[model samples]
Target: MAKRASRRSAAEDPSWACPCGTGLPYADCCGPVHRGEGTAGTAEALMRSRFSAFAVGDTDYLLRSWHSSTRPARLRLDPGQRWIRLEIVATERGGLFDSTGTVAFRAHYREAGRPGTLDEHSRFVREDGRWVYLDAQPD
Candidate 1:
C-alpha cells in the first residue's frame, strides 16, 4: 500500500557493488528493482533484490515486494543492525515461467556489534505476474 522510502542509498551509486553478493554493480543488480525502474525477472532475482533492500535500508522496496496476503501493516527495521551479505542456498520452480517458487538462503548481518545469520526457506509467488515474497516455509 505505502510506497518505498529507503533510509539510505549507497546502492544508488552505480559503481558500488551490490549487497546481494552477485558480483555485479548495484545498478546492474538490485538497484533497478529498488528504484522502480524494473521488476525482478525470477524468484531468485526477487530474493536477491530483497536482500539488497535490507542492506540499503530500503523498507519501502521490501514492503512493496511482499505478497499482499502476508504484507505487514508496518515495518520497523533495526538501525543498529547492518545487513552484510546474502547467500542463496537453492531454489525450486521459480523460473521466468513458473507461477510460484521457493528460495533457501542465508542472510548475514551484524546487530549491536554481534554477527548473525538468518537462514530461511522462503516461499514466493507470482501475483498479478510479478514476483512477491509470501512467507517462510516450515523446514
Candidate 2:
C-alpha cells in the first residue's frame, strides 16, 4: 500500500480541483450529487466527484452516486482516515445510451496508521438523462 500510494503521488495529477475543492465544501459541484440532488454526466466525472467526496468525508455523496441496484444500504467512512490522491486510469464513453460505461481508477488514502489503496473498475448507467455509479470490480 505504501508503494502504491507513493507511485500514484509521484506520477499523477497532483493539483486537480477534486470537483469539490479543498475547503470541504462541495455544494457548488459534487455536493449536489453527493447530496442526491442530481447525477453526473459521465462515468469518469462521477468517479472523480466521488473521490472528492471521500477526500472530504462526504459518504452521502458516495451512496447517492451509486446506482440504486448496487448502492449499499448503509455507507460510512473511517473517522481516522484521509484520502491522499486519486488516479483515473481509463475511461470509456459513447458505449451505450442506457446500458453501460466504465471508469477504472485507484484511490489512495491513509487510515489508522496505515496507507491503503482502493482500485476499482466501476460501471455506470444512464437513467433519466443522468449517469450514476453502478458498482466496482477488481482491477
Candidate 3:
C-alpha cells in the first residue's frame, strides 16, 4: 500500500508578508478590489496581487481581474493544496497608450502530498482602464 499523505489547506501554509516587509496580511493589504483599496495600481501591482490571490486560493478575485478577452469562464481550485513561494523575475512596460505589460514569475506549490512548480511569463493588458490577465508563455 502507498504511504498516507497529509492534506494541506491555505491556512496551514505560511502567510506572505507585504512586499514592503510591513508584516501585514495579503488579504488585508490588497484583497479588496471593489473597495478600490488595492495598492496595485500599475501592471506590477496587479501582478503581485494576482500572485497573492493565487497563494490564498482566491479564485473569485483572480477571475475578476482577468481580462475578458482571454479569461476563462471558470477557475478551479484543487483541494488539499497550498502555495509555497513566488518569485517574480522580470517586468516590462509597453508604451503609455499601449496598455500592455508582461511579468515573468515562478510559483511553487504543494498538493496531494506532492510538490510542484510553475514558471511562466504572463501577459497583461489594460482594458477599460483596468489591468487584466491575458495569458502565459511557456518556459
List TM-score per model, in order: 0.92, 0.69, 0.73
The sequence of per-residue lDDT tens digits that candidate 2 reaches over residues 1-139 is 3543432232233343443333333455565565566666667767778787777666676776777888899987776787877887888772445457888887888988889998889888875567778777665
Candidate of highest TM-score: 1
Q: Which ten residues in a row have the lowest lDDT in candidate 2?
A: 6-15
The per-residue C-alpha lDDT of model 2 at residue 107 equals 85
Q: What is candidate 1's lDDT per residue for 26-128, written digit by digit as tens?
A: 9898888888999999999999999989888898999999999999999888888889989899999899989999999999999989999999999999998
Supply candidate 1's per-residue lDDT for 12. Answer: 74
Q: How do the residues 57-139 of candidate 3 rate in per-residue lDDT, one tens digit apiece?
A: 66877888888878889999775666667677888883355589888877788888899988889888887787878888676
Model 3 pairs in collision = none
Q: For this target, which candidate reaches the highest lDDT against the unseen true structure?
A: 1
Estimate candidate 1's alpha-carbon lDDT, on a 0 to 1 scale. 0.91
Model 1, 52: alpha-carbon shift in Å? Answer: 0.5
TM-score of model number 1:
0.92
In candidate 1, how many clashes are counted? 1
